[model samples]
Target: MSLSTKSPKTSPIKIMQNRIYELLKQGKRIDGRAPHEVRPVSISTSVIEKADGSAMVSMGGTKILTGIKVETGTPYSDRPNEGVFTVNAELLPLASASFEPGPPDERAVELARIVDRCIRESRAIDLEKLVITEGEKVYMLYIDIYVLDYDGNYFDPAVLSAVAALATCKIPRYEMRNGKLERVEGESMKTPIRTIPVSVMIGVIQDRLLVDPSPMEERALDTSVILGYDSDSNIVSIQKNTPGLLSLNMMEQIIELGSKKAEELRSILVEAVGLGS
Candidate 1:
């Protein structure tokens, strides 16, 4: 008999190798990244001429555009002293192969909810100030987010774009005269916003944690978490994906990394809004 018995067929070995990879905890990823490296981000604001406020943010292959349109309206009955704020998100089919053309899906709804919570709960915009009257008059802020491209990690970039768009947005000045409103034009004015909230996503694969993972990385991830941070670097909102459990130490590490990323992103938003010197 031959000393090497035909290597026992390479096909079975290949299958075993694949199973080992799936079961084992690899040391590092193929990209040679530490799993915490965020992709290069590019952001710009006031891109849409028709929108009162608009911004676009691109991270790797993911691209998001956000626009804010503010108008006068009546306040809600429950919150008589608060203005109205609404968020709508769209995943255009052009963005990715998976996105279909139609009304918003569950993904879109989730995106909108995350971004909306980050802003509303963070007190980024002063809603009480938006109320012009007890219940009759108030300002309505409508934020529209468009996913022009999808590579993964859509929540962070979308929220960032929304914040930048709202920061750069200029609402028309209206003066109330005898229960009538007149548009005031001359110089521009700022919206009634108090702070800015930034969002970042972290991907966990085995022992590695990746920040701003690409589509492939996202697909292979065991879990993904999103953390929304305010200008003060305070946690505004946290959304977790996947049922996989993480240790407290891992959570702390991710928090530190996310906070750093959020501050950097917030600076970008400030610059886009002309708030940064």
Candidate 2:
């Protein structure tokens, strides 16, 4: 008797994955973009008049808005001379069906932390300058990020929005009166900006790499890497999502691509804020 030698059937998901891999082999993406091409980006600032500072960023289908609120608070014990800065992110249910209405989930927390690291590590803001009084009272900046739309990549746009909002932020002046911190009426000043930080995300599938992967590509990706670069082209922060091992050559490629893409994104932010490039 002859034994059956039929191979297992291929699932639709596998077929789609194969298609993506094949396209990437030709340096093309399903979205008709080159391997190193980022989606179209649009940025606007001062969207919210009530907020101290606000910015909205749209990258492809992804949309993110960031607002800044300045208040007086005691400095941290470890860094009494430096002001306090915090980042919070909210992934609204309207942004995506997968998101649920409740407290911040892991994804939201991760998004906030990544953006925070990018800014904090890059030293984009001069925290020392925000101090109102040494070891007593200082300016506390609250950066709130809202994900209004979900495409694939939220990190890049969220960072961009936060940076833009900060770049155009106006901190209300305060003074010490009767040993109390009093807000100076009709007085405000811009935040002391030291440098701008831009992040680039690269998705990897098999041996292929894609820049700014869309929602569909994100699902097909095996892993992804996000690198944040400062104005000096120095890598300030790096985060790798999902579980996958990258070869040495792929790491080198990602670093090179990330630096180039970061510069492009930084120029857009600078222009939006009227900062000379």
Candidate 3:
């Protein structure tokens, strides 16, 4: 039941790991993907009617769902003019056997925080427009991420879902009525966005650099990286998981590899977000 402990299921993964390592040595992957090739990407928007916005993304075997909810609340004292954004991730037990039925464990929390850093720090949303009243009322974005299928590399897929949900989110109209903020019927605006950020994660095992590694492959990797980029190819955020020494040259290579992959993924999002629901 302990989320932090490695599951006994890992024993089966060990065999897979050895198989993948052998394949990597031959410049290939078990699934017949190139070392830097990512799996197929597909997305669907407005998946939930109750939420303001929702999106589902599937990357090969991994499936993730994200919902966007805008709430009216007081703004932070220091950031009176800006809205607030919180990202919450849930590892549903149905998604995998290792997941438990309780509060999010460390894995879930870390996934949420990393996705939050990628979106929030990238300044993807125009938070100022979310403010209804100075220091009094502001619209806050609640991003709920559900891991329906965690095959591998939750970081990148989580980011994809969040961005898609946000891009398709409708900003509801609210006003100060009777000294309280109330929603205005039949008045909704598009979510104000400043930039689009895309994230790419790759696992490094020995001399192999693999994009979108499978769960088995991740278990055998020496290290991994999750990096975010804006439309202009600027690095927005970066997270290096586990403790391992990486050469500067290797890091640079990974950055270049990640940046290219992010651009490819961005196009998919752009097309999906442009659709009319």
TM-score for each candidate, following the candidate numbering: 0.86, 0.94, 0.93
Candidate 2 RMSD to the correct structure: 6.6
Among the numbered candidates, top TM-score falls to: 2
Over 155-202, each residue of candidate 3 has an lDDT whose tens digit, in order, gives 888899999999989878999998977889989887888878889998
Predicted structure with the largest lDDT when compared to the true one: 2
Worst 10 residues of 2 by lDDT: 1-10
Q: Which is superior by lDDT, 1 or 3? A: 3
Count of clashes, each model = 1, 0, 0
In model 1, which regions exceed 4 Å deviation? 1-33, 186-188
Compute the lDDT for candidate 1: 0.79
Which pairs clash in model 3?
Answer: none
Q: Model 1 over residues 197-222: C-alpha lDDT tens digits?
A: 98989876566566776554555566
